[model samples]
Target chain A: MARELTHGASADSVGTRPRVAAQPFLRRNVPILALIGLLVVSGVYFSLASDTFLTLGNFLNIVRQSAPALILAVSMTMVMTTRGIDLSVGSLTAMVGGVGAVLMRDGWSVWAAIVVMCAIGVVAGSVNGFFVAYQGIPAFIVTLAGFTAFRGIALILTEGFSIPMRDERFVWLGQGTIRNVPVPVVIALVFGIIGWLVFNKTPFGMRLVAVGSNPEATRRSGVNTAALLLRVYVISGLAAAVAAIVIAARLGAGSSNAGLGLELEVITGVVLGGTSLFGGIGTMTGSLLGVFLIAMIANGLILLRLDPFYVPVVQGRFSWARCGCTPMWRVSATLRRDSF
Target chain B: MVTPEEHEDGGSVPGLDTPEPDDFVLQASDLTKSFGSVAALRGATLELRAGEVLGVVGDNGAGKSTLIKTLSGVVAPDRGTIFFAGELVHFSSPRAARSLGIETVYQDLALCEHLTVARNLYLGRELTRHGLPWLDDRRMARSAEQFLERLGIVAVPGDAVVRNLSGGQRQAVAVAKAVAFSPRVLILDEPTAALGVREVEQVLDLVRRVRADGVGVILITHRMQDLFEVCDRLLIMYEGTDIARLTTKNTTLEEIVYYIDGGSGREHQRAGSITSAS
Candidate 1:
């Protein structure tokens, strides 16, 4: 009976590839190409517009300025891949900076303060994870509320003021570089590599993407979805805290506004790097490229003597265009008519 | 009713038929579950023999899915006993069920569309080399190729992302993943419901292939055509109750439907009158 069914149905043809194979290639590579094109265009424009733009000093400055944002972008990449968002990253960064500053003022060692601040960041992120993953709250809502509440806590703690660290060791970490590379850049690179390995090579990374792509299926496949979600949030929180340390060290102080609006830049970098906002598609390499693209844009605008405020507006517009156009082009270009 | 003795030899032997011993791979007795006031399952009993495809069929809301979830550890039964390999087992989580060799492939196929075929096939249990414990791409691709070839699933590049594959191919990959661990009992819920006629055949062939590998299959499907094609025995559930059990050769679809629609008396009468006339 089974053989009869097979013969009857086998006539329909078994191994024919779908009509369109070129679409996947375009879908995967187009955004990456676009990002590279944008960077090259901007780099050329800036180099022609300003004598300082192409210098090694300016390039190092760009890397230093982009390090915190890059770290946060890396964190966002992991969180968004799991179909969750961390709106509280900026606020969490500020809070960590505030705590570290307070501890430094109290005569704590620079390394000791850094350790305590990072621990606080993990705890804060874990709390966010607990509410979102364990208590079943939407990540957006939980982190959105956290965005305001944590920022308020930071502001209140600092009395709406900035506190400077006069400690030589801490100041050197912020202002000094090792072999012409800023310390923050080094830290971001190390963490970025670690993040990449964790997401790509480890079981934890596999489960993160699996849960993000299809939570129900992952659960059915026997994964603990809540645990994975919780871990992503915690990682995001730790990233934010690390960003705060970088920012504080660079400025030689912890400001209440240290990472204000940074979440937007980090998220922009992630999206610009081809990480989908709807989740389940992205790469650390893309995110790294994205951070550079956003940073270069801001730096280019400054070099052209444009108001820094316009940077955000231009970045916002670029993100909207990318978000609206890229996925549509991908869908129409790659997927077969019947597949949709 | 037919005597067990008449079909014993041709019956595929109750327990020793396969290499496994006489222990039931999975056994559920009087399993009951409810969602709020609605009873999804009530006192459903099932015994899965090694190397057999036991097909379950019923209309909508007949609790077929609930039973599969309970056995696969997706849901904790409100009442009853479950035994696996002759030891009483309570799966507090789905992971527990998997550890005990119970894997399920839901109709949605439970695949990550963004990931490649090899990645999806090895999502939970990926092959890893000694260094760094990273996803051993070469090993995974080789194993995935072998698994697909063993099942006769063709034309799929091992590195192709799942989203790029057709619906049938995705289903095939899901089934392959479930069978990757050599699960003792493979539970496939509506394995071919969404496929075209040809796709359905491919899935049924995969099901038969799994059974031939000495893994008992609990196929929860509503299609009578498929039931007759691959199932060794027929189990009819109605309103969360197991109303009839018969060998596929001895029972008819009409009788199973009658039992499904709560026509036990009419079913008995039809069987009685047919026997008398014969």
Candidate 2:
């Protein structure tokens, strides 16, 4: 024990060692690069298979159709990065759209309906956040409850009927175009860019990652982890509202069935984009690429006139194949158990 | 009430007496905490001085962790007074304590494995553009590099993900993060546990350097040898109470182990007989 106190031992062994080399660019971006390659291959296949696949009109159509899911994926990426899930998103979309359409059909101004719907989104998201962040409930469980309850509420709002929206101003939100770009596509792009900046360039984004990576560690570092998580759920809820508005205006109806099975689709795209299911890792670029890839598949399949049921089957297969083949998935799995 | 003089050499024992109040850089008296009906800490006390390394040792469930938690503001005490530099302070949160120059490196290391070393080093306290939310990643990386280099930690590249580092390297990074801000009172909880021989030596050497910078360090560990190596004084906790405070040179491993095993009842019988006879 006394010998351990020898003051002569080199304390600066760390100072004199050679610097380790940084990770190579390719190795770090393998997942992103792989997704890009897949996207290109799929593009070539679709273009060769269908005359409409490569047209600018078809490209804008695909972006328009994908706008809602893209917006949802942006928020989902943040949620999943914290090792949480908002299973209620699909149902939330229905509730917001259905309720907002009812308000507008009954003579509520379009802007007023939009404002109220956004507030609803905030309230619903806060409920989920309160339970998960403040009450210490698992996010999956809390949002699962939301999934069931919100859908029921949507059904109640519309009385199980699809109400037609007659407001031209509201209809423009979904169908209008700017310089040939669909309104939905424009909104998606704006949200996507903002999401990217918030996820990559800000202190809040960095802290969000830290919260997902190690909540206790982040808390010890003097961060308000609970507040951060609450904000994430709120964003998810708000995104669902925005998505709801787009879906309703595009369809020109407030149907209780809006965004049906949309949550799984968004999750699939996000996970395929290289975001881990267990939390702590996310890439905004990867998520966008993933959402675009899914949109391509849906559009290409329709152009080929395949059975609509085949779409999900193919998407499911793609997810498994992507997860199975990528070395990154293996890394994510190892990280959760921290076998390293 | 006899006032004890300061021991500049850190080689004198203060048996059955407390050091002068003003001599302590950090002073906590009668700290008590409870989780439900279970009392984790019952009237624990500790004193630390600048440029000194105080080792806290106790058996499992001896409340050493609870005491440290209370001091670090992770858990508020039910009853206690913590005076930092002779000013009574209340810590509502770890952030509050941190603002006053107190930093703690928990036993878990708290490094985000998926993030790069630089990101983890600046995890919560990221450097951002003035009045803007954008991260100054370039500056943070540069500063992280300098921090690691200054600590002689070259094996860990600033850009490397923490998950890929070895256990020793991870510990080194954790220490570097703690010392980066030059905290006044740094509390380390079992920093060298489960580390390799060379790694343990590196950590101890790092502790020596931190103390040389005139910071008061509180080292809590189960490793007895580590205490003798880096700790200036030993504060023994028994059943949630600090029963003995002895200079490192004046106490033997046997005495520390005895006190840790609930030997406070025999303090008078063994005190002068053990080492003060000289």
Candidate 3:
């Protein structure tokens, strides 16, 4: 079937029918398949190396630790599908958390602080969106400015200090368990499901892919491409804020130093999950696996008594190795088109 | 040679109280636009009757594209008037023109390569379930199939990604997208610019099918032979102004080529103009 598509040399036999034979499930999802294989191999290795690694408690703990990163990664998928990046997310997380912490310490209601955090997220995202969408600035440049500016604001707000939380209920959002599942895990699952639905079943999701694929074409089709791009950045920012709240609750403090270099981790996981860095292609399922893979690797490395520092090194190398395969698929697809 | 006034009267005339003689569906008169120092369209005018295929042929930079852009509302003209079914209208954007039943299939086809055929067909205008935010993919796919079948476009399935389709199939999908809306005025810009011999025939046949549906089609092309094959009348443009309009039944291919080549000299212009106006 692949050969038939690649070579128009046999046009006579195939006739004018351009009906592409449906690719088998495995063939269509090679990246996801590869990730699953890696997971199994790594799971086995970890299970043998550390008896505690395969335990249900350890698995739940991994989910809890990775919940915040997963939340950010899910939104990153949406942004990247529009061929956009949000370097500001890490810093936005810190800023939102720091501000929320300060507001709570000042005797503000938790609901009020949460609302304010979301508002800050919207404002910050709108600014980034305005420059990238309305002002025609590149997203990378706009978000890079946002990254520095937001982190600075967070540091200034918290006075470069960590403020401990006194509200047990607010902290419970992170540390509490519901029906034997950690609250953060449940939240992550909800986010994952919502992200999948929005990415696959909504017009907003389809337009993101279209805008990334061909902005001019989409604009010509009467779509407000600028607004679509703005919404994408806002979603990223909003998700970052939500993640920040979860992190703050877990830490029982709002720290200006939280989520440092977190943007790279989220981006790496999204890319590793088969969402193309170039945009126009994204998979929520793949992202889930990618985030889990990273978190598991980190946990297993610690359990194996390996230097905790090797976690980043292994992650960087593993992502490089996995993402390296992505371009090969893209190249072959390009070659097939060029053959025509 | 056929001046703008020589055709049917389409522009607004206050208190005239005279019904238009020609069944003209769309008309653009004395349209002019300039980008910085370069004038793209200078006094370009044309008329389209319902169920007629009007061929717009020109050399490179002849402003064929610019004139079409103005008519389709892609680019606002700096000066001119457009009449749609005898009502003077202004198009603020392509969406406005589309809402008024004018659909343009640009040279690039405006298809999202990563999306499936059904998805590309309903890119911006999506059908949601009970007007909710969720897409009605099943219904859209079903309707997409019906649309292709109605156009006699075979072999392309709704589920197939656009990137995998051949060039001809992609063109077919673009045309189907325009026609599915049941547009009154269908403008095709260089639809056959990038296609094999068979593919060109398929697109030309599609144009014929659209024309038979009583839609006014303005086809812009550089290929003289294609114009003769599908167009009812030819509007020849040169140096950003339409210089001649000729009926296919009355003019030879040589005559059309002469106008496209600037009619060479003043004598030729006079002769060409006289022939076209007559």
**What is the clash count for each candidate, in the order shown?**
1, 2, 1
Extract clashing residue pairs from model 1. Answer: A23-A334
**Model 3 clash pairs?**
B1-B243
Q: Indicate which candidate wins on DockQ.
A: 2
Tell me the deviation in Å of residue A270 in model 1.
0.9
lDDT (10s digit) by residue, model 3, range B1-278 = 12223222221112211326356799888999999999999999888877778889877899998998888878999999999988999987777787788988998888988888888878778878866789878667666765675565445777777887788778888877777777899999988776778778777877776676677899998777777777778889999899988777567777877787786766656566546534
Ranking by lDDT: 2, 3, 1
Worst 10 residues of 1 chain A by lDDT: A1-10
Model 2 — TM-score against the truth?
0.89
Q: Whose lDDT is greatest here? A: 2
Q: TM-score for model 1?
A: 0.89
| Per-residue alpha-carbon lDDT of candidate 3 for residues A166-250, written as tens digits (9 for 90 to 100) | 6988899899999989999999999999999999999988889898887877877778888888988888889888999899999
* Candidate 2's DockQ: 0.33
Native-to-model Cα distance after best TM-score fit, residue A114 in candidate 2, in Å:
1.7
User: Can you tell me which runs of candidate 1 are displaced by over 4 Å?
Assistant: A1-27, A332-340, B1-22, B194-202, B265-278
Worst 10 residues of 2 chain B by lDDT: B1-10
TM-scores vs. true structure, each candidate: 0.89, 0.89, 0.89
